[model samples]
Target: MNVIHAENIIAGELNEFEQAIRLLKRLHECKARQYLDSWCKRGEAGVYHNVMRKLDRMGNIYQPYADHETEITDWFPLVDCIADTAVYNLKWLGRMGQWHPEALASLTAYVCEQERLQAKEK
Candidate 1:
């Protein structure tokens, strides 16, 4: 999943939440769904489920990974969704004054390149 690459991406400058989201998006795009699902599962009884519930209680949104059995067979849509969500979240953070706009724009451009690479596979 190249999780380390994802972790190193933020350059240790962004907020923790931003870093986490970037890592999550990278994992999603890299087809590390199982890893993500596993990551979310670490509490008491059903820790992951409990964490999700707690996040829900706090109004923090968490996008659940697609269940392979019920998920669409196509990969493009999934990649597109991941890219779109990351870009959207980046823009949102910028708009909310949580991140520098110029920095966000640069990140978006890099993510766009990732999108282009994904598109070429199809």
Candidate 2:
């Protein structure tokens, strides 16, 4: 199975889809270029893949869909973990909302990492 890394796919940052598009442009520089390229053509088989293909063709810059905020929340590592739960619970909560719980949690974890990096800042 081909799994896209969160960082590679979205970086778990950039609340704006447009900014996410810009971030994608820099992914080519990642060490996993070959791995990513292998699946670029396979996106046609699925909706997500198709969107990815569209993004790829659009050159790493795209505006979010009008419903992006209501659909996909900011991705974070922790939130990513529980995102599915949050998404599922939305209906139970009687509110059609997008809450990336795991992603948010992961983002917090990432923040901790960033703090560590900052400690070594020169």
For each candidate, give its TM-score against the true structure. Answer: 0.26, 0.21
Per-residue CA lDDT of model 1 for 2-120, tens digit only, reads 22345366565676667667766665556544444442243223443443444453332223333333434555555444454454444345443333568667878899999999999
List the RMSD of every prediction in angstroms: 17.9, 18.9
> How accurate locally, in lDDT, is each candidate?
0.51, 0.42
In model 2, where do residues sit more than 4 Å from their true spots? 1-17, 28-32, 40-43, 46-75, 78-122
Clashing pairs in 1: 41-48, 43-47
Query: For candidate 2, lDDT tens digit of each residue in 10-96?
Result: 544445554433444444345235454443244324434544444454332223434353443454533333332332232222221
- TM-score of model 1 vs. true structure: 0.26
